[model samples]
Target: MSYELQAVIGAEAVLRKVAAQQPGAVVVPLRQGFALIPMTDELFDSATDGGRGDGLRFSKLPGGFERVLADWSTAGPLGYVEAGYAGGVGTQRAALWADGDLAIGPMFVDVNEPFPAIGSPISQVLAHLGATRRRRDPDEFVAVGLDRCRDTEAWLAVDRSVLPEVARSRR
Candidate 1:
């Protein structure tokens, strides 16, 4: 099915870096806008192996601001959240964020099936998170976090951080 998810950043939380790491933080642009770094390796592995915690839809590599930004820009705002799974056999879970706020479900979908259109539940989720079909610059928007939902209740929280270069670049 190969489902894809997208979200829009908020206005309050312009992407910024956390002082805890070097290079401060990095923002990777996508076709629609910029994105925070991909889920951590531990998180990705855990999700893929079906160990602990929710699973992720995408995986990211280590790199610098320019490279990530360039990749995101070219790749468009949309990227793989998770792949290599089907019918609960392989990895099928993915997490997407708008800023620091979780967007939708650990959106479970068959990577082998066609993605849902904008009016479907998945599409609505992406829309609620701010995703748009029109192209946008990451610097023009803010970032939000992603959350897992079942029925109407949210049960999980995914933290997101922005890149420091965003500020310098903006200046």
Candidate 2:
């Protein structure tokens, strides 16, 4: 029942543009006009040669991510959002870029530690992207259907056969 994700959020057309430009990229539609490009392990590996961090890396983003996002900002704003949860403990992180500038956070929320405000980091970013909160939903994250799957890889429906075998905690 736990979930995890790392993705770039933007308008569907904008995300499609980025997906077309970047090999192996795919857009997962969300509520509203916004969609997300899930940063799957394969994509991450190809971008960073097995996800190496020795050369260069952004604090929250992977290496060279900002440059790619900046180059693709012509269409619209882009936001990077990541989240993970298991055993009732989790964390979420989010950041936004628009017009080639940082618009909002690189914000982080600790869900089970000291706890955070009602609106989580991912929800806040979605709100900034124009995702409205419905009356019944607890937050924008669930409203966007992000809770539909456990991870970005699932969102993309990635072919597990092509991925390297690794033990994942599904408990």
lDDT assessment of candidate 1: 0.33
Task: State in Å the error of residue 163, model 1.
Answer: 15
What is the C-alpha lDDT profile of model 2 across 1-171, one tens digit per residue?
688888888877789877887776778766655678888766675555333333322223557666677667767888888888887688877877788777787777776664357577788888888777678778887776677678777877744233221112111
lDDT of 2 at 98: 83
Measured against the true structure, the TM-scores of the candidates, in listed sequence, are 0.34, 0.80
Please report the TM-score between candidate 1 and the true structure: 0.34
Reference-based lDDT, each prediction: 0.33, 0.70
In model 1, the runs with Cα more than 4 Å from the true position are 1-25, 40-51, 54-80, 84-92, 95-103, 119-126, 135-171
Error of 1 at 130 (Å): 1.5
The lowest-lDDT stretch of 10 consecutive residues in candidate 2 is 162-171
